[model samples]
Target: MIREPTKKKETSVTGCIRCGTCCKKGGPAFHLEDKPLIESGTILAKHLFTIRKGEPAYDNLKGCLLPSATDIIKIKSQKSARTCIFYDEESSRCKIYHKRPVECKALKCWDTREIEAIYDRNRLTRQDLMGDINGLWDLIEDHQERCAYETVLTLVDEIKASKTDPLLEKKALYIIQYDLQIRSSVIKKGNVDSHMIDFLFGRTIFDTLKSLGMNIRRKNGKHLFTTTIPSDPQPT
Candidate 1:
């Protein structure tokens, strides 16, 4: 007896398969076109974070970490994981599928041209969203100035060149402390949401330094650098 021929599985090369690979990598950065979503409260501020200008971040197109030219507001990933906060792992779907941001909409794992074309264009920034808010914008501006990565990186270079210079080390420590202090002040006094701290001031300086291979720890009430700085440090 002849057996029935085996049926081939169906597959498509176009469109998303809901594989969740992109979401698991991390959320997409917000573009200017996505501003309406935030303004309309469809995407709340607490669900997002910022990679401040000059901060080192991974460039999807370039395929390497580099200093960002402008603010890159992105959906926050789940705590202790790179998975996007909006992704529903149980269902393998996006919670805000319909109201997803431009990046999410443009992304097609099968065809990346659309996402790459607009990935780095028209990025939405804190100024665009909150520039009109009195007092708040001023605070954000001040924070950016005080904790600028350019300044911090320069200090790191100086500390590295003069390994035994206490002054250079102290300056770097002070900046880190100030970064931490301002976040606390905003949360307690300004009544800012704790979750917004990362967006407001980027990641903590301690985390940034650690990423650069410098380990910071407190001993006897003094912050000390425990690891030798990398000879050729990348921005991150």
Candidate 2:
């Protein structure tokens, strides 16, 4: 029987083999904001399996602290080996198609050159942001490899602390905490409260002087200020 190709929605990329290859642990990761879809009632989360720290990870080399069975997609090609935890196989489509992460929603293939190019560029910014966040910390590990994303997110806060813009700072801090929540790293250390991160990052208004490009040279690290640090907004 000959099958007809259906025209897909015109977005960034197209064509997924439905193989769970990309969704497995260590393949690509999800951040805090992305978890809402899964936690908010996605079918895939219930069936998706995870292998923990010492256990053998999925085809992508990621272990689950609590791995369970999720939906599966039969793989037709070696390149897309392993079933997708989100596929409905019987229907030949994604189970969480509408709520899939940015990466899954943005896949590309040989026929979609322009779409691939667009996806590549967009993916780079996100990947680079993760890399940037990783560089900011020294205690990061590759576990589920999700920790580094939050660590680097701290950098967004480093800048936020110095800005006089409360909204701007809150937005940046929100991004960092929001991401940590998605990665499930929010509870890793020191309570992982978004409010706490916000408090710490928020209270750091000292950055404004730091960003002025006017180096406040300390005499042996002592503040030259005869007064105390400003509590209210200074930069208008």
Candidate 3:
């Protein structure tokens, strides 16, 4: 039978040797750019941060976070027995191929130009973080608004989590921030935290933020009037 030529399979990024030089060896500090897919403006890449240091991105003791992605699978480099977290031994490519940070994406065996681009991009990340903080909050608020009152309630629970889980810390921060914003506008009369959160998540943010202080001053003597409707979760 006449022989037919077989086409070569497309190689993914996994084709590289297991040299930790790509990631283990530190380059300029870099951060993941969370740019909006639509915006085309010049982005000053800011560092979100390195996951870990004194070792490769994924892990130090264990080897690369994704060593399986490398062409040369195990950490044969005894000098630095670390492999990449994104390395896939099976396929030999970065797991984060699509979303790898600019530095990782710009890496090349011999291309100095690609290498330079990574450092150039690293210089611009600090400025990137400022807008993201507010933007993420806006996004969270949007989710709460669109999801009805359910999402904000989750925030309340999240705040109550604890020291063991990091979620509670974030939840508390979110609550405080929301309370602050609500208070920034509304000239509230009494207790601000609980009630303001209640209203902000339930009604117009503008109105909630702009509400006049409610039930202010002592009527006869003792208790100061604060507008806090306590949460209704009974002790379990």
Candidate 4:
């Protein structure tokens, strides 16, 4: 008796190995197509965080640092391992595999043609997700105009260089506090929930400024702004 020939297996990275490499890193950016998942409770709001436009963040797919070009909704990761919150290490599988984000569905590590094709298409914006709430849309637009972060940074430079008067620091603090107050007022008005405030604004302005090595403190109902002036002069 003779046995039939064995079929040779195809060698391609296109097929998932369940190695959990991608999931271990972080979850995918949610697309507009994934709005239903959030609405249906398949993906919880607690499982997400926003990457604000112009914010510097790591681009996992591209393996580089780049500022977000548009506000993007992304899934949160486990604080301990920095992996997707839905990823189950014990099972080596995603807990929500069946209902993963659109980006996750399009991802093909071996060949990224599919994901690349729709990378900029159907992107979920912060406004798209939460703009329906009354006053929230208007608040976001107003806050952006009121506190242009780049402009704030420029103000900081002016203060440090003494291009502006010494009292300019006080003025700058007033502006920053005013921005915060605007957000506070919006929250108090009951347009959006307090818990969801951060979602609407993304990371707070204080955090963003802190990342630039600036210190902000509120003492005795007054804001104090302090940052070291670089001793080395910038090249012209």
* Whole-model Cα lDDT of every candidate shown, in order: 0.81, 0.34, 0.34, 0.67
lDDT of 1 at 65: 76
Q: Rank the candidates by TM-score, best first.
A: 1, 4, 3, 2
Q: What TM-score, over all chains together, does every model reach?
A: 0.90, 0.26, 0.27, 0.75
TM-score of 2: 0.26
> What would you estimate as the lDDT of candidate 1?
0.81
lDDT tens per residue, model 1, 150-198: 9987887787787657788788899888888888999999999998887
Per-residue CA lDDT of model 4 for 21-55, tens digit only, reads 66765777777899999889898776777767766
Off by over 4 Å in 2: 1-28, 43-45, 49-81, 111-236
Residues 89-156, model 2: lDDT tens digits: 56766656677655455444324343333321222212222334553222123322432323323433
What lDDT score goes with residue 58 in model 2? Answer: 30
TM-score of model 3 vs. true structure: 0.27
lDDT of 3 by residue, 185-227 (tens): 4435434344323222333322221222122232463223234
Best by lDDT: 1
Best by TM-score: 1
> How far in Å is the alpha carbon of 28 misplaced in model 1?
0.7
The residue ranges of model 4 lying beyond 4 angstroms of the native Cα positions read 1-12, 59-64, 156-168, 179-195, 217-223, 230-236
- Model 3 scores what on Cα lDDT? 0.34
